[model samples]
Each structure stands twice: as C-alpha cells, then as structure tokens.
Target: MQDTTDFEVWIEDNEPDGYEEIYTLYRSVAEREDNGIWAVTTNGDKTFVTGPTSTLQLLSEKARRTFLNAVEALKSDPEMDMESWYGYERNMANSKA
Candidate 1:
C-alpha cells in the first residue's frame, strides 16, 4: 500500500441517475474494532468505507487528476490548506446545496 500521510480526494456516485455526486478527502485511519477510510466532505459531512483502495479507484478521471494535482501541491508545501485548495471551483456547484 502507498503511504497515506496526506488525505486523498475521492468521488462517489450518488445515484443511478448520475444526477448527484459526493466529493471527499479521505484518510486511512484505525478504529476500535477495525481500520477504514475516514471521508470528509466540503459540506462537512463525514462517512467511512472499509476499503480505501477500491474506493479510490472508483473516482472519475477528472477527479483523479484533481486529486493528483492536490497531492503534488501538498508535496511542495506541507502547510497547504486542503479544504480550500483541493476542490475549490469544483465544489462550487456542490456548495449551493
């Protein structure tokens, strides 16, 4: 597994109709009984998934590119603010709700 020191941007399909989308930054963390990915949305919603790798692979190409760019920026600047930097413009559409 890759080192998960930084949070990763992730995307999930909200429904079969493809009308809704959920975007998040996730980190692998340990829980009392098990380990999982802790996902936090721009809207401040929190969720969890058992397998981080699978969930990461599910992201769309555009989302994947955004995530990679964010990661690269973080590598250059350790103090970068993820919330503001990661999905700024993309989340504008989501923020309306």
Candidate 2:
C-alpha cells in the first residue's frame, strides 16, 4: 500500500450523467464494527468515503485528485469552480416536480 494516509472515492452523482467531487480522506476513529471512516480533506469539508478502505488504498493518484474534491478542493481544479461544481439544482427533472 502507498500509505496515502487518505483515499479518494469516486461517486456517481444524480444518475444518467453526473459526478460528485473527489476527496482526500484519512482513517478516522472507530465507527462501531471497526469500519472507521474517510474523514479528512484539504478544503475543510467532511464526508463519508462510502466504500471499503481496501478500495480506497488502491485508488490511483488521478482518481484521488478527481474524487477528493468533496472535502478539500485541491489545486488540480483547472476550472477553479467555474464548471466543476454541480448540485441538485442541476437535476432539472426533480426540480420540476
């Protein structure tokens, strides 16, 4: 293992065609079954990694840079929040309802 001390997990946002932010997460405290959590990022946002630690440890650098945006908006953001950020408002289908 590279001992990233953190991992980024890719998440599919609002189906059809969407992706959530990437995140650089680290091993947090025990949750209960010893399945701690990915609780750390450079941007100050905290969220659950939503997958197994084994998967995270195996993530590639590009994957981490792409998915780790959830917590901390890393420098890799070439657009600088111009078009990178997406939210529920974009899901016009549900909004119309």
* Global lDDT of each candidate: 0.32, 0.31
Candidate whose lDDT is highest: 1
What residue runs in model 1 are displaced by over 4 Å at the alpha carbon? 1-58, 77-97
The regions of model 2 sitting more than 4 angstroms off are: 5-18, 21-37, 41-51, 54-84, 92-97
- Per-residue error for 39 in candidate 2, Å, reads 1.8
Q: Native-vs-model 2 lDDT?
A: 0.31
Q: Per-residue lDDT tens digits of candidate 2, residues 6-96?
A: 4332322211122222212311211111222333322222222343332233234444444434333433444545233333324433657
TM-score of each: 0.23, 0.23
Flag clash pairs in model 2. Answer: 22-67, 22-68, 22-69, 22-70, 23-67, 23-68, 23-69, 43-72
lDDT of 1 by residue, 39-83 (tens): 322212222232344333323434444454543443223454544
How many clashing residue pairs, candidate 2? 8
